[model samples]
Target: MAAIDVVVPNYNYGKYLRTCVESVLNQADVAIRVLIIDNASTDDSRDIAHSLAQDERVELILRESNAGTHASFNEGIDWAQNDYFLLLFSDDFLVPGALKRATDIMEQNSAIAFCYGRDVAVHGDDPVPIMPGRTSPVAFRLHKSRAFIESFCRRAVFQIPGSSVVVRTEVQKRAGHYRTTLPHSDDYEIWLRLAMLGPVAELDAVQVGLRTHDSNRSREFAARQLEHILHTAAAAESFFNHEGGSLEDCGALRRLARQGVVGRAYWSGIAHLLRGDMEAMRLLGFAIRSSPVSAVVPPVSYLMSRPDLAGRISSFFANSARSRHIVF
Candidate 1:
């Protein structure tokens, strides 16, 4: 068996599949097996993936119907047999020599459930450094303790990108596979659970090239994604409660949820303001109440009771506001 099992989950990204596969296959100094799980792509992705799987190191699993990204990821994890696993997305590629570095770290630290490195975000051939200062959390960096893992789940800091992380097969198994209910943030949710299990090692090195295109989920549905994240945060809090976990570090989770709701409300308010609707202003006011600073809600609302202020705030966020790039 190979020393590592790599799972590449592909949807309709046929154009980028070959490069992604080649990058993994091209890695030197690491004994790795590659599994491509295609989610019934309407494009030629499956055919290309199957063609590439002819190599002994590569295998292809073609699904009859399109399972969502999370489902495909879980299927790949279930089929993985190596001591460690890496889930590479169809739109991403492993940087040269990244495999050696990631595998070496995992081998050196038995305690590390996973290790992640940095990434270069690409728009076509132009590369942009994302989360430059913050370390990549997606590639499981080091062996984590169970307490730490649980804490991560509670804190909701699993900002690691799925394509950038490498996980120990055992650690993943122990933590349980991805939760199917979380269609969008499955990777984030899983990493939170993993961090709860142990300490995550962070290597400040670039390991993958993540392609950011117009069709990417984050870009396509920013508002919906934010909403889902907020809902997921709430669900995570409930999960911890059922497990008898304490709420000591819950402040961060609450803050994150508040931020999402606030941002959503602010934007939605702007949309309503543009239409000259008073109900939208009222809804936005209610949303502000759900924020961490909700204590000042009545006073603030009183101060900005004018519909014009609501419209200005909405315009400010929609026009000049930047989304937080924090992975979690």
Candidate 2:
């Protein structure tokens, strides 16, 4: 059985703390230890941590002052002294037997750095849909380092759920601590770093449940789509500049990431346009200015395909070639 250390970082999440901690403790077949770090929460979180610490496997770190999320993340990295490590936020939890599933893949393939799977999310107080237990044979795929990076760099989404990712302790330390500067993209850069180190494993099942309440920071970030686009691009830049130097074709990968950013921004703007989000124009402008040559093509292609789209573009840009000629 692998020894796994789960660091549960809390901040006024007392209500969900017990369930989160319980989920970690109950992960089957692993010798589990929980480090509950209460970041000077005003709620009854400290008391809850103390009560949970009654179990020998649970430990508490109570701070009189509040350190930010990145600090807690780095602290967890420092506290990780087991074969496998996970940073499970107090509001999120591991799916039953998830750790075992991740560990099985990593243990079998020593070169695998981390394993990630899907996470089913629920809004405040809503029940998390239960994931049926898997009775079938699992076909875990081990993705090649460069190949996975190529595939990953083509999309701008946060492809993996944080709660569902389990990493190797030694590699996590080698990849280094989360950057305080890259606040929004800290996970983004780190995941890229981890993938660069070795093969990446992807589990087919939901490995964690992401619960969002009123105070959920992830939702706050998601609401600002423009910021999300900029921060994601920033993450790729930081990764290539700081750590991805040794890869054989680092330059090519970096270019792909840059193009991917514009692609994401363009699509995001169109999505907003379809929803009548007035902010769509702003995002489209950002994408166009970021790379005029590549960015203009997407909108241009859409205008050529549909007269309706041409009219829409003309409404936004009166100087469009199609609308000018159509009137003449």
Candidate 3:
């Protein structure tokens, strides 16, 4: 068996598939096995996979029908026969020396079930720093299994990009496979589940190039992605209840849920306010009043409730919006 198994789940990402595959193959020091699970793409993705599979290190699995991203990922993980696993997406490229660096970190830290590095978002030649703008939950902190889950339940601080992470195969097997039902945010859900098993080690190095284009999933299905996040937050609440977490843990989970709801309401309200919709302003006001921070930020709540004031504030911010606020 190979030392590490790299799983690439592909749909209609033919344009970016070749570059991603090539990047993996270029890793010289890491003894890696590559698996391409194609979700019955109408494009030439299968042909590209077949070409890569000509190498002894690669294998390709062709699904009969279109299973979503999560299903494809699970299928690949199930077939892995290695000590470690890395899930690389079709639109992302592994930075040079990433596999070697990640392998060394995981080997040195026996207690860490997974390790991830920073991800640089690439739009053509320009590189965008993804994690520096916001604080990450998984960085600079070594967490126990339950603590990691509780923290994630409270707020997802780390941007756990798939291409940049390497996980112990046994931890994944013990935690059970990825939940296929989670169509969009399956990676986030899986990370939470893995945190229940062991600690996650993180390297401050940037090791993956996550390409951002017009056809990216987030840009294409913005509303659906938001809905998935809200649903995942709710699911985490129920999971925590059944596991019998402490009162403090439960409170943290509830806070996380409220943050998700408030965030959705706030952003949706902004979108509507930009379109000059009074009903949207009222809805946003109700959300602010219902949120945890409402009591302290009563002025914000009051302004959001009135169409005129909300419009004025929205316009003022539109002129010079420096950064987006995190409602939670």
Candidate 4:
């Protein structure tokens, strides 16, 4: 059996699919199976996928019509049959030896259900840079289920990059499929569920190259902050509304997450208001709707009180990537 089963869900990203598939096909020190699931692409993606399927390690699932991302994600989850599984978007590629590094940590720590590392973004039409894994290996940072949620979800901030995360096959199977309703933040929501299963391993290394282009999903959401807020909120709701709420301190965690989202939203709103830009008022509106109590406290007062948050909102919203980076 292969060490890992990588599911590459492609749309019309023909230019990037081959590079993404080949990245895993070319990985050394680990055996991986690649499944290129094309969701009725209209571009040259089908041909490109067929050509890549020539490799014995690669297979194709060409859907006649588009069934949506969650469909592909769920299909991949159902098809995974290896020790490890990764749902890699067609726009991302792993660096050399990334699989081995991540798998090694999970193997050593039986308590860990998944592992993730850093990922650098490459712009359009560019090749994934040659990163031969991290030169100086750092110790793996392990976060218990609730602890990981506290560090990330409490602030409605996302730290894990989807491409960088590698999960245990059985654990992923148990975590269940990606939800269709959370189209924008399904990745975020799935990470939350997986963390609920066991401790998460954070490896200190750049493991994947996440390509950015006009058609990229994260870029689209960054341009629509209002919709993005709702999507992320839906993810949190999905998690707590399920059995995940049984975790210790679930109520406190939920309250803190709401406060964090509401607080930062107000701060973002204040920044935009200072510039006389009403477009960002969506942040304030969302904050008010999410938590009336938190929304009443002036954003500046919140920032002043928590000195640590002084420049977070300003810099986060300064650019699309940074803005999308905060509430993954």
Candidate 5:
């Protein structure tokens, strides 16, 4: 059996630590080691992690000061000794047979750098897989690097959630670790770089249970609409240059991607307005600053009252378009 190392980087997430560690241990058909790195959490994370470390398969690293999640990601990646590596957040867990499913495809295709699957959102005790009615149960696909890059640029595939992805250990080392500079979009940047080296495979089945709560770190940063917009723009610029795209192509794609950013910011501002938040104007400012043209493009008439409905309508149009990147 191939060996895999799963790294769980946590900060004040002690309450969900046990469930996260247990899920890694439960993965079958693979030799696995779980590394729990706690970043000086204030909660009972230390005691809980220590107890979980008592198991032979798990190792606990206690940090003296909070180094942040990306720092912990680099620490775990440097320490791993397995064939494959997965960085699962403390709040999420793997579904049954997830390791087997990803590993089987990776082993058979040596050129594949990484594999990812869909997620099942868990609100309470029950896990609800978000597979749509038309989704296939046993469908999977492999995309050559160039094709994947083009599709990714056009927003064909949905964002690959970091928790549900497993990358070849050596490929991670060669492609480099997550960027400490990009706090908001490091996962997206890394995925783009990895796709440049080899193919990326996708499993249609849900592999990770993504838990939603008020304390999520992502939510905290996502609310800062300007930061999100800037980071996304930076990632697109960096990826476009790295892929050796022509100047004309880069300009066109960058404009389209930034327009998407502005559309998101506009919708976010509307959401804030609906909730009676004071930051609505600030988000609107960000939208206009990012892309003045895209900011003024009125959304559908029905979207004026419900921002959620606007998102669904926008997504339908995005998926339907093939030749160009659709921004709102």
Candidate 6:
């Protein structure tokens, strides 16, 4: 059996540390090791990590300072001596059969870059359930190398759950480690890079428990939506540059990417408007720049709703849209 190293990067998640570590420890019939990298957590995480390290299967890396999750991932990757790697957050846990299922697929087909599965999102303090379904309904579904990448370009959202993914260590190193610069979109960018290199495998059922809490990056992204929009657009641009094509194809692909960005901004702007957030105007401005004709209608309708601000409408539109046209 190929060794599977599961790195649990934790920061102030001491309460849930045991549940997360035990889940990895309990994964059946695989040569698995758990690395608990506590990022100078102020809570009881260090104590819990020390306890977990007593088990021969578990290793601990207690950082002196919180260098952030990306840094933890890089350090963990360097420490991994296994064939496969999983960067599991301390708050999330794996389903019982996840490791065995992922390992079998990777062992059989060496070409697969990574294998990912859907996760059951557990909100707040809910207990992680024993996922009831076929572990391997079919031999894993193989995604064509660039198929997922092109799909992401056309539709600006990453569907894979980060914790549920098992990546080939060699491929992960070759693709490059997570970019510490992109706090919210590092996983999105790395996944794109991996997809570009080789085919990805998709397990049919849920294999991970994704816990949603206030500290989750998704929540943070929602509060500062413009950042999310910009990060996604930057990732798309990177993909477009790296996946070169003929001039016409490149032009067409660029337009499609822009359309995807504009669509996301359009919908997200409407959501902001419904909530009466002033950021709606900024997002709408982004949309308008990307697709001028389509983006103008929503903002115009919004302005019509607020007759008192009629005088400032034109000026607001002019100034907000003045920034270089970023597709959402």
Q: Pick the candidate with the highest lDDT.
A: 2
Tens digit of per-residue lDDT, candidate 3, span 14-132: 87888888888887577988998899999999988898899898888888798777677778778877889888988888877777777776776787888888877788534433332
**Shift of residue 328 alpha carbon in model 3, Å:** 7.5
lDDT minimum window of 10 residues, candidate 5: 298-307
lDDT (10s digit) by residue, model 5, range 1-328? 9889999999988988888898889777889999999999999999999898888999989999998888899988898879999999998988878888888888888899999988877764444453332222346789887666655454412367679899999988887778877777877778878877789998888888888778886767756655765677677667666642543466676565555555556766765665556577877787777657646574333234333455755664565444222222
The TM-scores, one per candidate, come to: 0.71, 0.88, 0.75, 0.89, 0.77, 0.83
Question: What are the RMSDs of all candidates, in order?
Answer: 7.5, 7.1, 6.8, 3.6, 6.8, 8.7
Q: By the lDDT metric, which is better: model 1 or model 2?
A: 2
lDDT tens per residue, model 4, 98-150? 88888878878777889999988899878667675554345788888888787
Stretches of candidate 2 off by over 4 Å are 128-132, 135-137, 299-328
Question: Which scores better on lDDT, 1 or 4?
Answer: 4
lDDT (Cα, tens digit) per residue for candidate 1, span 8-90: 88888898898889888987777888988888899999889878978998998888898777787778778887888888988
Q: Candidate 6 residues 61-90, lDDT tens each?
A: 898998888888998888877799999989
**Cα-lDDT of candidate 6:** 0.77
Cα shift from native, residue 220, model 6 (Å): 2.7
Each model's backbone clash number: 31, 0, 3, 0, 0, 0
How does each model score on lDDT? 0.65, 0.82, 0.68, 0.80, 0.75, 0.77
- For TM-score, candidate 3 versus 5, the one ahead is 5
Local accuracy of candidate 2 as per-residue lDDT tens digits, 131-225: 66653235687889887777656665456799888999999999999988898889988988988889999888888999987899878988778
The candidate with the higher lDDT, 2 or 6, is: 2
Q: For model 3, name the residue pairs that clash.
A: 136-157, 137-157, 137-158
Instruction: Assess candidate 2 and give its TM-score to the true structure.
Output: 0.88
Between candidates 3 and 6, which one is better according to lDDT? Answer: 6
